[model samples]
Target: KDFKSEEEKREYMLYLDGSNSWILKPLNFIYNLNDKAFFLNSDHTFEDAGTTIEIIRRAFENSKNIRKSDVNSKAILIKEFVDEKNAKKIKEEKEKYLKLSAKFSCNDLHLELKNEDCQKFSKDSIMQLIMIYAQYKTYGKFNSVYEAVDMREYEFGRTECVRPLSVEAVDFVKLLDKFEDKQEIQDALEIANNEHKNRIKSAKKAQGVDRHLFGLKQMIQKADDKTKKDALEFFNSMGYEKLSQNFISTTCTGTLDFIGYLLFTPVVWEGLGVTYLKTNDEVIYLISYHEKQKENAKNFAKYLNEGVEKFKKIYS
Candidate 1:
């Protein structure tokens, strides 16, 4: 507003200290004289020194601010400008292909459509492929978003030759069914041997186990009349007291649950000079001798029956 002469503006620009101005550099408005030469010859040349620099600086600043404001606005504008109904166009383009075997190529869609790779496909195959892609994309909500553009590639008369197998067909066979023909008995033996070894190791190392230690003595001392009466009845039923009297006390120190031991640990009898007899799928101990030693066999038979009857009463 203070500028009153043509000389004022020329000297103002020509001698302006903008070259030393830090503010002008950041705004990209710092003007060398040669670049500002055209403006020097223009009609509004009578502007003041500080005022002209401030005005030019403000113009650049306003332009930068305007651009910053327009970033989001321009993006929305471009999106709004696109045809929202381009799904139909996309579908029409894809409808030309009968097979989509490879990954989609954006570089040569036109050439791909022009090629003879596509052949006639069944409508059912196309429908199946459509469902596959729809299910893949929508994660099972194909019923709603089926008409979207992203799914248009599915309607292209294309079919995937590979179809997923059913759950029953894929998962029905048990492991035993597959492996039994090869090594069923070997696998069973392996498992049984491992269990036996673990049990033997645990029993040998069970130093402080107190659950069943002194169990018989504890029960006898704590017995009510009913328990004492039950014990007497069991002895009477088996004549167990009379039978045990015949076997020396030193040989039969441990009262064994002989039936349980026989059932679960049949291997124990193999070392005791007795052969196991299988009759009606039940195991019975037999003493077999080829030398006609009938006395030894008879003694073994009595001992076996005595042990069996004693175990039956105890376990029962």
Candidate 2:
């Protein structure tokens, strides 16, 4: 991949910039010679995390097969050898435990909840705990909460938003805050779980409210002048602004064994982004946030851990 000269490299770079053929193969290979590492970068516009991970796994598998064939061949094949000494030094320099206050931090907390616990309580039960923590952090008010729902069942479909904040969720959180009655709390939790399930179902069917409103806004851009004026006025209203602010953005990235961790910045400056995976024996969360935001990712993780313990006690 090396060019003949500096001028040739410059020309090749310009050619890539001007060519549209790169869109057909949108994967980037990054290598760190000092650390002896290889990284594959996939653009989010073309692939979601799930698809990207699958692609990477297949690519690695193919490479392993090729290496196996080379082992049996008598012909010599050029290979890049790893610098073990330098790689070990680089690995040692990287911190094992990172503080959440660092810019664009990520924290992965593995909980004690098992697959049996997941079966005993719905996923909504876990989400209810998250909502309670959000309320605690926001001083007893439920902010706009979002969860991404994959809509790839339809042709050319992408994702839809599932707003998790609801009247039932608010009631459940409030009851847990004030009362300790087991039956009352269980009933409220069940109601909230049902409401959440319904919302998720609606989103999966592409009947969610957010995307519909978004589509309307897009259409308004090409509407007649009078219609565009009214649509713009409505979309620009204060109520719409409040509704659009997602204070807690969350998504469950499924239980793919190859996925070690996932992270994304908060949607809004003061918001929190949470991507989680539930394994057979534990739940892992990768919480992300801005350092200067009012909310602290570490504190939120602590609250969520406590909430998990409380949930375990309730079901125990």
lDDT, candidates in the order shown? 0.28, 0.65
Best by lDDT: 2
Tens-place lDDT digits, model 1, residues 1-316: 2334543433333223333332222222223454333232111223322233345557657776686556563422223232546756644544432122011110000001111211232222212222223222222211111100011133431111121111221221121123333244234323433433343344334421122323443575568988877765654554433322211100000111211111110111111122122222232332222223334334434434433232122212
Best model number under TM-score = 2
lDDT by residue for model 2 (128-223), tens: 455455447554466777777887778977788877777888777776665588688788878888888888888888788898998898889999
- Ten-residue region with minimum lDDT total, candidate 1: 105-114
Q: Tell me the spans in candidate 1 whose CA falls farther than 4 Å from its real position.
A: 1-182, 207-214, 217-222, 227-316
Residue 37 displacement in candidate 1 (angstroms): 99
True-structure RMSD, every candidate: 44.5, 11.1
Cand. 2 Cα-lDDT: 0.65
User: Any idea what lDDT model 1 has?
Assistant: 0.28
